[model samples]
Target: MNQFTHINASGEANMVDVSAKAETVREARAEAFVHMAAETLELIVSGQHHKGDVFATARIAGIQAAKKTWDLIPLCHPCYFEVEVQLEAIPAENKVRIESCCKLAGKTGVEMEALTAASVAALTIYDMCKAVQKDMVISQVRLLEKTGGKSGHFKVEA
Candidate 1:
């Protein structure tokens, strides 16, 4: 069986030691989706929503969330990184898709950071549009791809 990196021999939870690991450029991409009513999406797309620019607000939230991933998630390492978040509205589907990419030159991977950014951005979208639609759902939050580290590159099959 594979050993858990965040667990000690005695089974106590602990942060992984990466002091000897090589510092290489690591990147990860994640995505999330927020489903809502067509009317709600229209409000956002037409810029008629009283809550203001949902995309701009959600983008900032994602970037901030990625930077603070270490503090938000236990056992995550603190590393400076760059994150780009994009939000797209699909009126035909009545949903918003959020994508986040995180990159850093560090010993540990930034998968968590990318995932966090997408998740938080989805939540922010829900928060901003809840007044008009309470049935919005945040779903499909997942890592699309990751590169670098000892495990090497991984990409989800489309």
Candidate 2:
């Protein structure tokens, strides 16, 4: 069996050395789902969230989260990145879909960054709408696709 890359035989966490790993342009995308009351969804669609400009605020939070992924996840390397965050509200179903794409030039891919951005954006949605929809739930934060780097490309097909 393969040992956990981040853990040593001594059961201590260790940062993986990537000194010999080739540098490459890498990109990754992640997605998340936020479920809320249909009435709240309608309000969001009508630009009625208690906080103004939900989409704009969530987008900025996602970008900031992507840039700070390393600080949040101890093992992750701090990477310089380019990122885009897209939010689509489904008023009919009282849900929102958040997608975040992250790119970087480094030895390791930015999959964690993308995933973190998606998760943070989803939480931001829940936070911004909690007063109106206390039951809001954030779910299904996951990596959708990734490309470049040593591992090559991966896609989580629907």
lDDT of each: 0.95, 0.89
Q: Which candidate achieves the best TM-score against the true structure?
A: 1
Taking all chains together, the TM-score of candidate 2 against the true structure is 0.94
Q: Superposing every Cα of model 2 onto the true structure, what RMSD results?
A: 1.3
Q: How far is 25's C-alpha from truth in model 2 (Å)?
A: 1.4
Model 2: weakest 10-residue lDDT segment is: 41-50
lDDT over C-alpha atoms for residue 37 of model 2: 86
Question: Which segments of candidate 2 are over 4 A away from where they belong?
Answer: none
For each candidate, what TM-score against the reference?
0.97, 0.94
Alpha-carbon runs more than 4 Å astray in model 1 = none
Choose the strongest candidate by lDDT.
1
